[model samples]
Target chain A: MIAEVLTIGDELLTGNTIDSNSAYIAQRLTERGYWVRRITTVGDDVGEIMSVIREILNRKPSVLVISGGLGPTHDDVTMLAVAKALGRDLVLCEDCLERIKQFYEELHRNGLIDDPTLNEARKKMAYLPEGATPLENTEGAAPGAYIEYEGVKIFVLPGMPREMKAMLEREVLPRIGERKFIQKKFLAEITDESKLAPILNEAIERFRVKIHSSPKGFGKFIGIIIFAEDEAKVKEVVEFMEGKGIRFMEGW
Target chain B: MIAEVLTIGDELLTGNTIDSNSAYIAQRLTERGYWVRRITTVGDDVGEIMSVIREILNRKPSVLVISGGLGPTHDDVTMLAVAKALGRDLVLCEDCLERIKQFYEELHRNGLIDDPTLNEARKKMAYLPEGATPLENTEGAAPGAYIEYEGVKIFVLPGMPREMKAMLEREVLPRIGERKFIQKKFLAEITDESKLAPILNEAIERFRVKIHSSPKGFGKFIGIIIFAEDEAKVKEVVEFMEGKGIRFMEGW
Candidate 1:
């Protein structure tokens, strides 16, 4: 399956943030046998986020995971953008509003926040797209949304690393699918990366496997990761490359 | 000026790498007074890289900095993809070829490699799109390309962080422009981010300054960054927000 990650935040665009969130999401999706086609990052602006989401939907990826801009702030307009992109209206999830209220109240009770009251800003977190199921956020106030629009599953997640990771594992992963591919990492003892290119190409062409090689350093070690349906296939490709004079050390 | 970054690498797509390169590029671009609108990451496939480059170009960004897939391996098709995207031809850069040969030969001379042969793989690094200037890579063999296409300045740099950073600083930064922004980072003493929304939005609207806010925690501190053309403009926004009862520390 093909997947795409869209991370929305002004911090990301201006480089105030390094966006380790997309990498985490991409790795999880890749482990689940999804070919993450692309990862796109835009600011927290609704128009830009909406335009990019529409473009991603047009490409018809099997799944789309959107992270960031789901908070109560004015710039956190991801939910509104997702609704606009899907041609859906934003509707209040009463259940979500109740949870958000409790979350704030609990924070207030613990002296973490000054107010336990729900104002317009806090109330904003309760709205989801018309057809989206509110994904529970056990770690944060913003409730994620899961929408299946025109055969593509789109998820809106929080931007905070701790919150996004919790929501993704608890709410997102269970919905995508099971992991199916076997990925083996190895360090190939090649004198240089260029010398390994031709043999690597021939191996990939011969075997029904996917291989990615990157230079580890100037000399004798290059990192190569092999992906296949089973261990046998990985071994076959490994043997073929080994026969071509590439020495391998498992798992660097 | 508006800018965008496209990072091409299978490792990035697979989440094997976190794409810290784009963040570094974006930060430098922002410091240079460019609004980095979007950052895109795609695999090392030629079609994928070319299509994304064409899309980014279509947006008419003032500058586009592309990193990754600029190596000697078979997957390093960035130059070829860039040529196709711009409807140009990949021509051999004679000076670049000499440098690449020397780079590899030096490694061999240092006993870093078994041989320093200019095979098709190694020679691939010396090609640049027609009419593009070859950017010197002081950290690696592959020479980057700087192309001025249809009013957009496009830079293709290496995937390695050390190489990309060196080329970006030594070659890319000098060509883009001088740094021209004043960014002030502050920790706003707010009860919650939700409460800071309307005031933050109003400050941005009143002053010609950009404001980005993210929650530091569930507590009374939220990180806010202000971007303005001058220190006076930033101070005006800061005072306006302070008038709204949001106490701010000088810096975080």
Candidate 2:
């Protein structure tokens, strides 16, 4: 299945933040056999967020994972954008409100908070798109949400790395399940990538496998990765390299 | 002026590579007063690359920086994609070819390369979109390129972090010149972000400055930044905070 990741935050666009969240999500999805097509990042502008959601919907990715902008602050507009794009109202979800209340109460009990009252800004986290199911957040205050629109499964998570990761592992990954593919990495202590181009091209053409050669340094070493769905084809490529007197070190 | 960044590579999409290039470019552009609206990443597929370029063109960002997919491998189809997107033919640039030839010869003389002859794979780096000027790469084999379509200035740089940074500083930054803006940052120890929401919203509504409050921890500290073109307005916000008896630690 094909997937796309959309990260929303002005901090991201302004370079105040470096997005490691998208990389983590993409890696997890790829390991589960989803072909991640694109990763698009935009600021907190509602129009931009809405436009991106509309585009992703038009593309019809089997899975669309969105991160960031799910916070109590005014800048946190991802939920509102999603609601507008899906043509749904921003409604207070009782379950999400209950969770938020419990979160604040726990903080108060722990002497971390003086006021446990849910203010307007804090209550905003409980307002999700109508008909959306809230994904419980074990790490933070705002609960994530999930919705299905026209065969596309949308997963929305918080921008905080800790919260996003915990929710993704517990809530999102199970929905994706898993698939098997043959992936192998081989390294050679050679300098120029151009030197390996011919052999790598030949093996790619012969075995019908995707090969990537990255030059680490001018005269140092190169890392090559061979990937394909067919295990036998990957094996054949390895054999071809061995027969060509090219010694490759194993492991990624 | 507004800007956008497009990063191309399957490794990035597969999460094998984290994109720091876009962050670097966005930071530099923001420092120069360019409002970076979006940062888009796609795989090595030619169709996806071309589609993203077309979309960026349609959006008409004043400065569009593209990095990655400038290598000699078969997957490096960025130049081809840009050529097709602009409806221009891919043509060999004599200057780029001479530079590539000299680069290999120098590497051979330094005992870094055994073959000085430019192979087909190496020659691929010399091709540029028609009417595009090649930007000298002081650190790598492939030279960067610059092309102007309509009013948008398009910069295509190598994917390698070292080469991309070197070329950007030496070639791209000069073309953008400089722009001045008033910016300030303050840190405060506080628990709930909701507590500061009202004040921040009032500041944003009253002044033309942009404010961002980042929660460092649950009840530890928050970093706030105020940015604008007017220095007096930024100062007003700081004075206003003092008037409200909100003590904030100085410095970014």
Listed models, DockQ each: 0.64, 0.54
The sequence of per-residue lDDT tens digits that candidate 1 reaches over residues B77-171 is: 89999999999999999999999999999999998787788877788889999999999999899999999988999999998999999999898
lDDT of 1 at A220: 57
For model 1 chain A, the run of ten residues with the poorest summed lDDT = A212-221
Write one digit per residue (lDDT tens) for candidate 2, span A1-252: 899999988888877788889999998887677889999999988899999999999999999999998887667899999999999999999989998999989998998877888887679999999889899899999999999989999999999999999999999998876664556777766545555778888888887666776654553556777877666777788889778756678864
What are the per-model C-alpha RMSD values against the true structure?
Answer: 2.4, 3.2
Flag regions of model 1 displaced more than 4 Å: A191-208, A219-221, A229-233, A243-245, B191-207, B229-233
Candidate 1: chain B TM-score equals 0.91
lDDT of 1 at B99: 96
**Candidate 1 on A152-209: residue-level lDDT in tens?**
9999999999999999999999998876667899999865566787887788788856
- The Cα local distance difference test for each model comes to 0.88, 0.85
Q: Compare the candidates by lDDT and give the number of the best one.
A: 1
Candidate 2 per-residue C-alpha lDDT over B1-252 given as tens digits, one digit per residue, 9 for 90 to 100: 999999998888878888888888988887777889999999887899999999989998999999998887667889999999999999999889999999989998999877788888789999999999899999999998999899999999999999999999999989986765555778866555666777877887887566777655454567788777667877789778667655688865
Question: Given candidate 1, what's the lDDT at residue B131?
Answer: 98
